[model samples]
Target: MNKFTLLNGLVVPLDRANVDTDAIIPKQFLKSIKRSGFGPNAFDEWRYLDHGEPGMDNSKRPLNPDFVLNQPRYQGAQILLARENFGCGSSREHAPWALEDYGFRVIIAPSFADIFFNNCFKNGLLPIRLAAEQVDALFKAVEAMPGYRLKVDLERQTITAPDGTVYPFEVEAFRKHCLLNGLDDIGLTLQHVGEIAAYEAKHRAAQPWLFA
Candidate 1:
């Protein structure tokens, strides 16, 4: 897990609503839990013209020129601007993995599915919920300018536009703490390593037969 203090990156507009987990990373690619290599296959159906398989050469596949991601202007974008109900449908963690692998650290949307939103925090991706009007304005601003970028400050809980327009967003304090410290579930548990070891040793001494 990576600590997400602040990020300033180019924005890519998805321009669609009701984007589900399967759409983010199709079902076929879910076999591997490696949390990587899925970047190439993110949004497989919409990103490419042909059907996508697990081991297919994505480089040779025909790309959808009309799709926002394939556009040259938005290349190397790290912030995804999306609409309402983003990350709906099945609660697969792969969605955020694909997004993170594709170089997006933060996702700004009007709304997000509950499960997906939670998964983003665990996986080091920042899922931001803002007012519908604010998201619309951002979409417009991103489209109006090429190579548009935004600065996201997690500690300050603010997103600043190029013109210095600041948009305030809310995030739970506990989640903020975890992200700031780069602590995932396992990382959190490991924080009490000494206590866990001591407890185990005490238990072994109390019940030597169990250890034997």
Candidate 2:
């Protein structure tokens, strides 16, 4: 996991609400837990015209030009500006994996499903909740300007708009700390490696007969 400090990147507006995990990274692509190679298939149904399957050549597939992601201006976007109830439906960590793999570091929305929100933190993606009106304002800004971008300061817990407007957001202190230090669940556990090794050694000595 990479530490997320500051991210200044183009924002792609996913206007619809109630975006479920399946929509983010459809059910078919969930078979792999490698947490990678899913970027090309992210939003498969909406991103392309044909039915998407595993191992399909994404490059040759026909893209849906109307989709926000396929729009030329939004290419290489790193921040996702979404509406309420984003990541609703089934709790699949693959949603965040697809987004992160596609290079999205931050997701801004009025609200998010609880499970999906928690998964985002564990997978190194920052899911931000803001006031509904604030999100609406951002959507308008993104539509008004081409190549619009925002600066997200996770430590400061603020988002800076292109016009110098700053919006303050809240994040749990523990989640904030984990992202700042790039510590996932595994990373957190590994911090106690020495103690774990000692405990295992003592257990082996006490239960030598079990091993034999």
Candidate 3:
């Protein structure tokens, strides 16, 4: 996982609520757990006009002109501005994988599903919850200006708008620490490698026959 410290990047609004995990990355493409290559297939159903499948040539597929992501101005956006209940439905971890793979480091929404919210932190994606009115303001700003961007300071736990307006958000202390250090569950465990090795060595010596 990548450490998230600060980000100043373009913001694109998805303007939709109740966006389920399936829509974020369609089920057909969930065959791999590589946590990559899903960027091309993010929002597959709405991004393309035709049905998508794994191993399909997405480059050749028809793109939906009406889709927000397909618009030229929103290209290379790293911050996603969304409405309430942004991520809902089945708790597939793939959803955050696809979002992170798609270059979105931070997702700002009024609310998010419990599981999806937790998944985002594990995948190094910052899912920020703000007041509905604040999200509305962000969505409006993003659409009103091309190349709209914001500054997200995780350490400060605040989002700075283009006009210098600041919004303070809250995150669990443990989750904040993990993201700041880029430590996932596996990484957290590995931090105590010496202790783990010591315990194993002692166990083997105490019961040598068990190992045999």
TM-score of 3: 0.88
Predicted candidate 1 versus true structure: per-residue lDDT over 1-212, tens digit per residue: 88999999999999999999999999999988587889999999999999999999999999999999999999999999999999999888899989999999999999999999999998889999999999999999999999999999999999999999999999999999999989877867899999999999999999999999
lDDT of 2 by residue, 1-212 (tens): 78999999999999999999999999889877587888999899999999999889999999999999999999999999999999999988899989999889999999999999999998789999999999999999999999999999999999999899999999999999999999867768899999999998898899988767
- Report the lDDT tens digits of candidate 3 across residue range 39-72: 9999999999999999889999999999999999
Q: How far is each candidate from the true structure, as Cα RMSD in Å?
A: 4.2, 4.2, 4.3
Worst 10 residues of 1 by lDDT: 180-189
Q: lDDT for model 3, on a 0 to 1 scale? A: 0.92
Clashing pairs in 2: none
Off by over 4 Å in 2: 189-212
Whole-model lDDT, model 2? 0.93
How does residue 13 of candidate 2 score in lDDT?
98
C-alpha positional error of residue 183 in candidate 3 after TM-score superposition, expressed in Å: 1.1
Q: Is candidate 2 or candidate 3 better by lDDT?
A: 2
